[model samples]
Target: MKILITGGAGFLGLHLAKYFSEHFVGNKDFCSLLDIAEFDKKEYPKNCHFIKADIRNSTLMYQYIKSMDYVIHAAAALPLWKEKDIFDINVGGTKNILEASFKNKVKRVIYVSSTAVYGVPKKHPIYENDRRVGVGSYGQSKIEAENLCFSYIKKGLNVTIIRPKTFLGTHRLGVFEILFDWIHDGKKIPVVGSGNNRYQLLDVDDLVEAIYLFVVRSGHPQGVQRQQGHPKGDLIYNGAFNIGAEKFTTVKKDLEKVFIYASSERSESRSHNKNSSRQARTISKVFPTPAFFVKKALWLFEKLKLSPLYQWVYDTADKDSFVSVKRLTETLN
Candidate 1:
């Protein structure tokens, strides 16, 4: 069994590569990591092969995807990227990947989509069948890419779309890195609002497990084998499914937990140096700001290119943002 992972240099891509490397240990089972960015070989397992290739290159993608048992499409232009680049990579690149995989007759293709497609929806526990209202170029491109997945599925390609929430784990950088730095320095963490919203987040490990299940397990529901009048071509697993943490509290509580953990670790270290004259630093506090004013300021900063945050983030910070993972759980079970 051979597996190929697109966007192999990204945070999620690295995690997926590490997770799959452990399972594909057979002498014949090889994993290929394809990305436009250069990969650090020391960071990846020895069983993995790195290919410096762009998914937008149709010829290169087609050539690499040949004879692959599985393809995990985790590549996408993030929200911070330029609008044109986002569309080009997320939409255009996705088209190339699907086209290549379809033509090569790959056994399965797992598309790592985002919950951003829901786009600050008015309802809670957004379902798989919910109407997608993209908030920005990134979100809109995801919806368009998902549409391509559906089109290919209709053409008899085995594809599974996994829509995951904002996931964090080891080696995750960007916004979370900034937040961790603030906490480490004992700075006040400013939230957009009261920080009372139940914003769900997924652990990268949990997401990797979900993807592995989708890859190894049969697509059919338990005890429901194909029979007369049944739909064809792994329809159950080929559809879109939401993925998120099953348990999470409000934003304030979650931040407080992290603060508490940081304080405990500091205390443990201070115990070894009892004679030190320096005072112990304080843990960070969550400082809530008015959402209206903060949003206005963020909007101005975005217009001035002073901040990386976009509308989808600050606009939904104070609102309830979560999705129903019941479908995923039941299907995988």
Candidate 2:
């Protein structure tokens, strides 16, 4: 079947492209990658087609989405920008894709939403029906964009919404680079707060598998419906699912793991030298940057356009934000 993926050169999108390419290579009509920027040919499968186009171009969206079996709306303005005028790309672009998909009768659309829509949750293990008070402009735009998907769904579009948290894997390089760099350089790793708050992070490999489950799986098992709202006797599983890992770790412990891994590699590399010490370098203490200080620094960085973490990371760093994946697990099973 033909499939179209927007923002195909992005971190998550790149992983999705590689996953589909390896799984469906040699079928030239299997998949197409659409992005505003050009991609490296050597990085993609031999058969996948690459299209340089913006999703905001309604005509382009129509021309490409036409006659496609599946469309994954993964393009969005991540919160790295100095300004928050992302409605054109985040909300308006989604509207264009959905309108085109509806007109062309696309079979299924995997709309990738984010955990940012939930803002700072007041409770742990946030559910799908939890409050959707967005924190920043990026979050606000995502909420609006998600509403567009549901609007199309009401018009008979089979759209599945996947809300994933801060996913990490090999392709991750933006904010994560800070951690990797500090760890590799044997510098003190900084934690935003007291580091007791637990953060849920899903591996990209696991996230891709979950997306595969949604695409291939059909009908939920009996008595598996766990939605909070819907009329009685209606067993339809709403196509929305919050994707997160079951296990969670404190920010401090997670950074320590990175430190340990980096130290091991350093030790192994230096072992050949007779002057190298036998003991591994361990970081016994962490630099604890207060949340208020981080916020102030982020504000200044945004003004100066010198920071990559920006407002999104600072807004949620000290908060306990995690989703309940029980619904997703049951549906997949």
Candidate 3:
């Protein structure tokens, strides 16, 4: 199927684009990207076209989107601590994508919404049925965008919304890096409240898989309505699932754990000089490696609470949300 992925160069978008391109490969009729930022062609599987245009430009969007079978609206400005101007970008940008999708005769739209739509929840594991009470500018704008999608859905547009939890990938700039860096530097990761605030993070890989399945199923003309697994048309389902590893570790605990885990490796050499008082030439180099050095730097930064990356952990504290998801299987892999 011909497809268009907005913000294709972004962290999540890049992964999803690669995921689809690999699965579809040469057989795809067309799978293009639309983003104002230039897409790195090297990262992509094929020489797919990327239209550098913002979603806010309706005229340009409409011109390009008039006949796409699938529209994955992955474009949006993320939530910020402060708002510069709301009209032209976040809120308006969403409207532009939805309206263009409608005009384009796009069969389905797999909207990548945020769990922020349900802000400062009164309950843990924020379900799709829960009330949406956003906290600040970011959440508020997402709610507006979600409403636009629903409004379009009311007009008979096939819309499937996926709200992602805290996401981590190879090339992201939000908050997770700070904590990881802090842990690397051998520093204490600060916990906002009690440190028991369990949260789930979507690795970019898993999120891409979820989006792929959602897109393929939502747009499949031969899609069957199986109540147990596959999502149906004109329906709303929670896309963000609890996806962090073994167990949820607090900021402080996570740092200590990571440092301990990394440093726990045993030194291989020194057996020959085990209990001797002899001059030993160095050979068993384990600690003080570049990776080790970087981790140490991160630790120092986290302790100081000076690094912007470390501050990201401080930000995650206020967000009280986690995902409880159903495992989605991929046919491609």
lDDT of 3 by residue, 1-333 (tens): 788889888877778777787888676547888888877778876746778897888898888788788888888775432364443566788788778888777877878877767766667765666788665666777777788878888887777777777677786656667755554444444444554556566677877777676666554654434333544432433233223232464443544455655444212223544654432232121122233344456557755755543323334453455754543232222
Candidate 2, lDDT over the whole model: 0.78
Model 1 segments more than 4 A misplaced: 219-233, 273-280
**Candidate 3: pairs in clash:** 184-295, 185-295, 185-296, 185-299, 242-323
Off by over 4 Å in 2: 82-85, 218-238, 272-284
What is the lDDT of every predicted structure here?
0.87, 0.78, 0.64
Q: lDDT by residue for model 2 over 1-333, one digit each (tens)?
A: 788889888887788878877776577758888999778767777777889999889999999999787888898887754234488899999999999999998877888999888887779889988889876778888899989988898998878888998888885577787767667667776678887788888899888877765654422223224333446222233457899878878887777777777777877777767576544465434678889988898889876878766566777788786899988887666
Q: Could you give the C-alpha RMSD of every candidate to the true structure, in order shown?
A: 2.8, 4.3, 7.9
- Highest lDDT among the candidates is held by which one? 1
The TM-score between candidate 3 and the true structure equals 0.74
Q: TM-score of predicted model 1?
A: 0.93
Question: Candidates sorted by lDDT, descending order?
Answer: 1, 2, 3
Per-prediction TM-score? 0.93, 0.88, 0.74
Q: Across residues 1-333, which tens digit of lDDT does each residue of candidate 1 receive?
A: 678999899998899888988876764438888899888778888888889988889999899999787899998887878899999999999999999999999878999999989998988989999999899898899999999999999998989999999899997577899998788767899988999999899999999999988777644243244322456435577879999999998999999999988788778767887776643388999999999999999989987888989889889999999999999998777
